[model samples]
Every structure is written in C-alpha cells, then in structure tokens.
Target: MPLFEDLPRDIQLAAMENAARTTLANRYGITPGAFTLQQYEDNCVYRIETDTGPHTVRMSVRDGRPPHHQASELAWLDSLARAHTVTAPRPLTTTDGTFITETIVEGLGPSTVAIFEWVPGHAEPPFREPGIAEGMGTVTAQLHHHAQTTALPDNFARPTWDAADILDRGYALTHPDHPLLGANGAAVLRAVAERIHARGPIPERDRGLIHGDLHRENMLLTPNGSIAVIDFDDCGLGAYTLDIATVLSSIHRLCRNDSEAYADFAHRFLTAYEKIRPLPESMDRFEDFLLLRDAFIVNFVTSSTNTEVATWGPRRVAGLIAQMQAHLAGDTYPGTLTS
Candidate 1:
C-alpha cells in the first residue's frame, strides 16, 4: 500500500476532510452541511453549504506556510475589500475573532484553517470572450494600484517571487535530477534561470505585492460583468509583471489553437491595464517572465502530492522544456509574449 502522501489525492482529501469536520462547528460556529471538497493541491478547499449561504474553508496542508503567512494573506484581502480595489473573497473570523484556526489533520501535520465569504461569480468562464481579457486587466491594475498606495499591516509577509525564488529555487524544489527532466530539459531550465537572473533586480516601481497566481481560473466573471479575482493563496511580493505573465501564459495554453486570438487577448489585457497604470518598462523582456511562470508550473506539478498531478507531471515537464528550448533558440513558444 502507498503511504498517505503517495495515496490517491481523493483518498487523502477524504481523510483530511473527516478530520476537519469538527472545525466548522467549533471554530466558525456553523453546522456543516454538504461540505464538498473543491480543490486538493497545496491546500484543501472545501465548499461548505449552510442555511444562510455557501462558504469556503481553506486548510493549509503543508507546514511551510505558517499561521502569520495565512493571516497576512487575509490582511491583504481585507484591505482590497475595504478599499474597493477589487472584488476579493473576504476571510471570516473564527468564534474567537481570529483570522485562522489551527487543527491537526490525520496524515498532514498541524494546519492553518480559514473560512471566507463565498465570492459570487461564474467559475472558469471562457477567457477568449470579447471583454474577459479587458476585465482581467482592469481588476489586476486595480489590485496593483491599491497595493502601491495602501500600507499593509507591518507583519504582512509572503514568499518573494524574485528570479532565484521563482525559477532556480522552484526547479530545485522539484528535484533537479528528476527523471522527467533529462539532461537537455535540465539544461534548458538552467539557461532560462540564468537569463532571469541576468535581467537584474526589478525596478522599485515594478516591485510590489502581486497576486502570484492570477491565471484564468482564478479570475471570476461576476453577474454585474465585473471580474472578481479569487484564490489569494499564492499572493505575495514580486514584480507586477509576474501577475501579467501568469494570465498571459494561461492564455497561451488555452488559446494554442488560435494565435490571432492570443494576440488580441494580450493586446486587450495590456491596453486595459495601461488605462489605469502604465506597464512596467521591464515588459520589454516579457519572455523571461513567461519562462519564469513556466518554471513555477513545472515545480508545482512535479512536487504535487495529488495522484492526478503526479500522472501529468511527465507530459507537463516535457511541454515546459519545449517552451524553454524555444526561448533558448531565440524563437517564440506558444506562451511567448505576443504583444
């Protein structure tokens, strides 16, 4: 039999869910009904149903992200909600008025748990819609503007998404010697990492709190037609271009069949973004940003405990290597910046 971490992701999630059932009543003072597991990646997200309305409970399954980090994420979300910068899911406090509740899961160790008010919107809508890219750009710009002007709590802390952290460190986390990444694939990754480092430090204006994972799935289309960004689980400090690269890479993957649409999507996003704030001059080297994002994806897939992700790791790594090799050859990959 496989170990807990090696077990199928659904089994692991079910075990964790069973252990966490008491949390809803004891921490958030709600009688849980139909608590369905929504996501089981670095964290476990449960879509909890109640008489009043649905809520979201996120449990950090790893030890690397401490309670303060979770609190800091909530702090930024709260700031965005208060400033009306964007429609972000707001965190709900426990019965004791605290942001996070600590609990021990069966296989996973001590975990940080937080409940959030359900964000209203359609999930995973088509990104190629006429206005979808524009909405993403607008909401992203709004969030960045708020981050630049507003002051986060002094204790606010999240992982930095710099070159070393984003590329080299992530690759290392995925295990440099992993069989999926043969000598050629490993060399391509190293070359991309070197290019990222050679780009030098980010200019002060370009560096700030960024939603580290603002891909298409993370942006929700609200009923009023506004874009609502969710899943702040990866929000952190980094160059604002990181967020741009995230969405653009997603567009590249999703729109691979139509380069024309990809170009239009990139154009619409940047145009709408500039309407609020000028893009960072560093965007001249946007390929590095895209490659950086690709590297992160490789690490995420390779290191995931989820059996589904594990199964996809080899193919995903191969695609990422091809993209990296394309860049190294001075040619454009599907995700290379079009506009």
Candidate 2:
C-alpha cells in the first residue's frame, strides 16, 4: 500500500485520474464516458449517468480512513433528507447492498467510494444577489434545529471537531514553517489557540451535526429555487458557530476586508437565522471559528498531493492571518455584525 505522497507530483495525479476511470469501469461495471470527471485531486468527483438517471460518484480520495466513518455520514445524510430540513445528496447502495464500499484502483490499491444523487443547479455566488444570505441562513437554521431534535442510532459514530482535532491538524500548518506564516502569523496562531482555550468546553446546545465544510462550492441552488447542500464527507459533531463560520469564511475571502459588503451579508444571515433558530447576539466567536477553518485548510492543503492546492496553501494561509489581525484590531470585517 503505497501512500499518495510516496509518488512524485505528476505521477500521483496521473495515477489517480487513471485509477478513478478504471475503478468506475471495472468495479462499478460502467462504460467509458458514463461518468464525466469533474475533479481530479484529493477525490475524483464525477457526474455519473446511470440507468436510474443522474448521480455523482466520488472516488480515488484518501484510502486511509476507516469505512465506518463513511457509513456514519450516509446515515446522517439519509436522516436529514427524511426529516426534510435540508436536502443532501442521498447515498445509493452499491450492487453489494452497502452504501459505502471499497474499490481497488489497481496500482492505487483499495479506496473508499460512494454514489450520491446529483443535487442539480449551480453554486450561488456568495452574496451576489440580495437576500441570498437570508435563504442560506434559513436553511442552516433548519439543519441545526433538526440536528438538535434528532436521536441517533446507538452504534452511530462520528468524529468531533475539538482541541484534539485542531492539534492533529496544527502540525501540517506549522511544519517547515512556510515563509508565508512568518513571525506575526505564528503569534496569531498562538493567540487564537489561547482565546479558544479560555472559552472552556463548547456548550452542548452549541454543538451538533454540522455540514463541516459548507462553503459556496459545496452548495447547490436546485431547480425548485432552494439551496441544497452537498459533500457531507466532512460532516461531524462540532460547534454550531463552526458551521456558521464556514459559510462566512468563504464570503470573508471574497469581500477581502470590504466592511460594508460583509456587514450586509452578516445582517441578512443573522436576521433570518434567528427567525428559525436562536442566533447569539454576540458573534465574537465568529472570528475564532474562521481562524480554525483556515488552519484546517492550511493543514488540508499541506497534506494533499494535488499540485494546485500545494501551490495555493501558503499564500491563502498568509492572507487569512492578515485578516485575523485586522479583526483583532476591531476591524471585524465579515462575521461580526447585527441587523
């Protein structure tokens, strides 16, 4: 079992793409062109057309994760869909009667893959249209509300996004100490960690099943003109603020310190979020979660074998650190507003 990193960059990507296509053709018994490859990096996402119509297939990602973690995601996704609080890509069981199964990608070895109904429609541009935030907020609140009320199966298992998770990812962001992080960046990381520590344990009410990576790209504006979420692979139990911050995190990057634009988004989302579920008056924890998400990405990109992410990671981390500094100085550009 050769690790993805053991191979050179070009070799790693070529091998993955080839393996993905082969896995679909062989294990899934799909012909060539049945699945159009949408992404070829950490995971190979394809728009698959089958006898049952259209679905998305994710394959050729990290093979290291245990299969049960994937099963837990499917369990919750099915529950969310049934509850009608939010629509997620429903998992389709494989020929073998299991939703989450493994496929051997020849030279790449065994990799976990699953099929999901393609939630149609393009990604809503972050805050491009007025009231989009309200719609997103309403949907998020519904998701949280449902999560709070639902009971899980006794055997259900999911990871926690906590001190341990942060520590696990911290090394990747710190190692070789990229020139981008520099001295100020290092200090900011330390201060943010301390602030998070001072908050004590996250309150139970503020923690539940969250769409752990709920950025614009992972969203779909369905034909019914509703916001549908996709890619729950990162879904887990965590701070409710973490989920809220994930949405704003992408908007923050897009706004690039434009306080007015960021404030508009914050106002709309908070106003609507509170309509369905209570949102805290003080959004001070927003910036902390933003930093946490950024740190996670830095670590994610660092570990990825994808050439593009490897090149972009350092610069993105540096930019986020600078924004965090402005936030500490009371700039509070994006997620710190009230309507």
Candidate 3:
C-alpha cells in the first residue's frame, strides 16, 4: 500500500502513459505532466495536467469497478449533460473512442483507468451556508426529474435501498471472529435490523434513478452561488425519497452543534425541492429512511479504510446508536413525510 506521493517516478510515468493512450490524447497534443493523487476508499483519482489543461484519471483496483463500469458511468453522465440536468465531468475518449485503459501499478493491483475533462469549481460547506440548501434541493429535484425520462443501458445496476439490504449489510460487519465485533456492534446491528423489519418492504412503485450519494461534499459551488453536483458513482435505480433522506442525514451531521441552523437548512432544501418535484404522499416514510441512511453510514465507516472515518468512526457510531435508540423510544423530529 504505497501512498500516492511515495510511488516511484517510473510507476507514475506508466500511469500517465496509460492515460494518454486511452484518452486519445496523442491526437490533441495532450501529454501528461505533473500529477497529484486524490485517493478515496474504492479508487485513486489522479489529477494530471496535460497540454490541453487538467484532466482526471481514475483508477479502481477492486474487480468489476473499472473499464465497463467507467464506460457505463460516462454514458449516463453524457446523457445528463446533454439534458442539462447538472454539470458532470465529461469523459475524454481516445482516437478509437474507448473509455478506459488497463494499467498495472507495482505494489497495487491491476487497475482500469479513464480520463475526464476537469470540472472547475470549489466545494462549499453546506452546513455553514443556509442559502446552499435551496440550490442543492433544486438540483436534486431536477436530477430526479430528468432521470425519470432518461433511458438506461442494459447493464446499469440500480441502487438498492431496501431495508433487507441495509440489515444484511450491517450484519455482515461482524464476521469470522473479527476483533472489532463486540456487544456494542451487535446492539447496533440488532437495532438496525429491528428498524428495517418495522419499515416493511420498500415500495416497488417508488423506485427511480437516484444520485445515491448526495451529501454536501459531493456538490461544487461557483462564485455566483450556483451549484454543480458531481460523483454519480452511486447513481442507480432506488427509492427517490432515499436521496432526500441522505441529504437530511448529512444536514443533521453537519449541524450537530447548531440545531437551529440544521432546521433552517432542512426547511430551505425541502421548500425548494417541493416547488419542483413535490414529495409524494408516501414521503411520510422519511423517518425510516433516515434511520436506514444513518445505519448505512455506520456500517460503511466501520468497514472502510477512509482515513476520516477511520479516525472518527467510534464516536460517530456511538452517537448514531444513541439517536436510533431515541427514535425507537418515540422521540420525533419535525417535517412530516406527507408534506
């Protein structure tokens, strides 16, 4: 596990060469220059400057995560861009029009890489800015609205937000005598399972294409206060309300110290979104959705190698378990799902 910065120059060159060939950069005089790595849990994103400006080359090590996945993702993104749903990174194609290049890193496993035209903007902290909620809400509504009519390819895997899936994932966290498994973990798993059972099965009619992950960190902001959404890696067919639930859960986490601000942000987001898409009568199920969303985060952080979560997982899990207990004990938050 060599850190991106620690990789020898030769390996970096190989990655750069692979990117150039795949993106058809030879045709546009685009040669890789200095590179910086932005590594996430499942992939490594290299920001490579070329003759044509900056482009991103994303490499995923886990099998089934690249080449085909990249191609499918770019197709969906291209559709969204054409429909003006939101600003997404445009995939750069080679002279042959292929979307990915296969490459091998010395210490890391084999990877599939793709080049994307860089999207310029900065990410603003949503909890710190009240106005951002409206923009986010509006963008989310528009995204869902557009996805409804967009034709998906045969291989597109729709996201599953079913309660059964959530519970099964949580249960998988404790396995084969892993040291992290304990009474505390067991309790959390049980709580999540009980919540899922109480919620019943996810309604079949509510399924649609959703961004899957809509936290504030995934949005970019321009100087004029306009926003652009990115990272459709999790985009798939699922409960549309689950997207709203993800945003609300993120708001809760962001505004933990300022309850009033959290309420304000939630209000603004819902207000703007409803003006466009108008929540369904079944939106009353949001509380259940919130519970499952929080559980998913808990399981993901505990199971992942993400540094931020690695440092913060224990405390966050405790807080979330407490919140779940409170909800189970009849504590209620405002905002009716029916509204």
Candidate 4:
C-alpha cells in the first residue's frame, strides 16, 4: 500500500510552516510564530521563533501514526521530564487547546501537527568533546530505567519496532521488487530478520518503551553538560537493546571508513553506560538488534525521494548493504565494548 507521506516534496513542504502558522494565527487571534524548516526526514520540523521565546512545531505525515498516537508519545515525554528521567521536550497546545491537532490536506489525508517548547542546548556530535559519548551513555541508561519502572498512561499504544516488514512494507520507496534491493534481495532481507528472531523471545525485563531513534541528531547537549533528548516520535514497545542497536548502527554507518574512530566512540559510550547500569547479559544479542536498526535506515533512505538523499542514494545504499553484510558476518565491528 502507498504510504501517506508519499506526497511529492513541494506538496509536503506546502502543507507546513506558512499554512500552519496562518492557521494558528486565525485560531488564537494573535501573531503566529515565525517558522523555519528545521529538518525533513521522518517528519517536517520547524524552528518556531516568537518574541516571547523560541519553540518548535513538528508536522508528521500520518504514515499510519495519527494524532492520538503522537499525543500519547507526548504525554509520555511530559511524564519522563516531570519524574527527572531525562530532560525532554514538553508539548505545546495549539489554539484549540490540544497537544495534537489534525490537518487534512487535499490529497495527503490528515497529518499530525504539534508544538513543543524548544530545548535550549545543541546536540553536539558524538565525537565533539571528550565526554560526549559518556554523556549519551549516562542519559540513555536513565531513560531505559524509567521505561522499566514508570506506570504508563492508559491510552499508551504504539507498534513494536521488530514487527516484520513494518518499515519496508510501509515505506513508499520500497517493495519486494524494488530495483535497489534487487530481486532475491527481498528474500535476503526476510531471512536475516528471521535469523535474528530465532535467537529467542526477549525476556520481560529486557522489554519496554524505547526511544526508537536516538541517533546523534535526535539529542542535544545542554550548556550545563547534560543531555536533552528530542524526537520521541518513534518511541514504542521493544527490547532495550533495540535502543542500543539504534545508536550502535549509527556509529558504524557514520564511521564506516574509519575503524579506529568507531572503536573510540563505542568504548566511551558503552563504558559509561555500563558504569550506570551494567551492560545487560541479554546484550549478547546486540548484533541482531544492530542489523534490525541498520535495515530500518537502509529502508528509509532507499525509499525516500529526498533530493539530497537521491543524489547520494546509489553510493549510500551500497555502503549500507555492505555494512549490513559485514555486521551479520561479525566482521566490520571492533571489540563489543571498550574498557
């Protein structure tokens, strides 16, 4: 089935900022916040500048996730912040006094729009400073611990990250016969997924709400040397290792050309995280989770028509496929964790 975000670039951009700001102005009877496009990956992010203070307005094409699910995710973030689990973005109400509002576009169907008080600090690169990796580890442990003990809301519901074909089937750019994946390539993808699952079902303690996409850009490093996590839009029920795998896959893809750089980052991040909460023995299954995470990225890029991505798609896709092969073969990685 064609995904909801299948709208062409111009149409998608047209549904954002300018229209959203005008709608807000008409509803609230006040000046709307000035909006500048921030990012355009899974969602259309805008930096909202107002005289009062800066905020953010995020619009996601309802690719099966509706306003309610987005609201549930926001509610969870609010709770996490209140309980000191981690510094998180707080939901901003629209003029209708709701955290999430639905906007029906001509052909794209209904999209979810929400606002958040922007976090002040920047998300530093993982290798930017000495303790950056350690900080990521420390904060991620705190989030996992929170997911373990907190009482979630009644309406809390989101799909598990591991459900087969969830991303591949839903992505508009991918299908069983896509040229990039080739013909037998479809079979290869499923076989790897099955092999990963055969390792056995995850134990109860190892599963819970996860920030499904915590790669570097999704986080911010505040001036006080603390972490401010963002983009919980992808949070859902899954193995805690799913979260680790997401970050690990990021390190591998980013430093694919430099093994030494990968080692330095993997060590500091793993060492600091283990210091807070010892690496779960369940982590022996980490490579499996890594493959799953990398597959998610590969699916997104190949399926996307983003101009910049399309420009480099051929090279990037090949590199990702190679990384996946080496990862599954246990070849491209260094020590599992650095001391």
Candidate 3 clash pair list = 23-94, 24-94, 158-237, 283-337, 284-337
Residue-wise lDDT of candidate 3 within 1-339, one digit each (tens)?
676435664575566446445444454336677777654455667778877788877766444444565677777777877886577778776556766666555455466767788777786444466568888888888887877767788886444556666656543345413334345555656765776687576666677787778877778886667778777776766678888888777777666677777777778888999988877444767887777677677666656554545677777766776776766667763322333
Q: Please say which candidate is ahead in lDDT: 1 or 4.
A: 1
Model 2 alpha-carbon drift over 4 Å, by segment: 1-32, 167-169, 173-187, 280-284, 325-334
Candidate 3, superposed: residue stretches over 4 Å from native = 1-29, 63-67, 125-130, 170-178, 306-309, 333-339
What's the TM for model 4? Answer: 0.85
Location of the lowest summed lDDT over 10 successive residues in candidate 2: 167-176
Candidate 4 lDDT tens digits, 94-164: 67776777665555556677777788888645564788888888888889888888898788877677636
Tell me model 1's lDDT, rounded to 2 decimals: 0.82
Q: Considering only N, C-alpha and C atoms within 3 Å, which residue pairs clash in candidate 2?
A: none
lDDT by residue for model 2 (227-289), tens: 888888778888888888888877767885686888788778778999998984225566667
Candidate 4: where are CA atoms >4 Å away? 1-15, 26-30, 62-64, 95-97, 105-109, 124-128, 163-174, 302-308, 326-339
Poorest 10 consecutive residues of model 1 by lDDT? 166-175
**Model 2 lDDT, full chain set:** 0.72
- Which predicted model would earn the best TM-score? 1
> What are the TM-scores, per candidate, against the unseen true structure?
0.94, 0.85, 0.82, 0.85
Assess each prediction's global lDDT (C-alpha) against the native.
0.82, 0.72, 0.67, 0.71
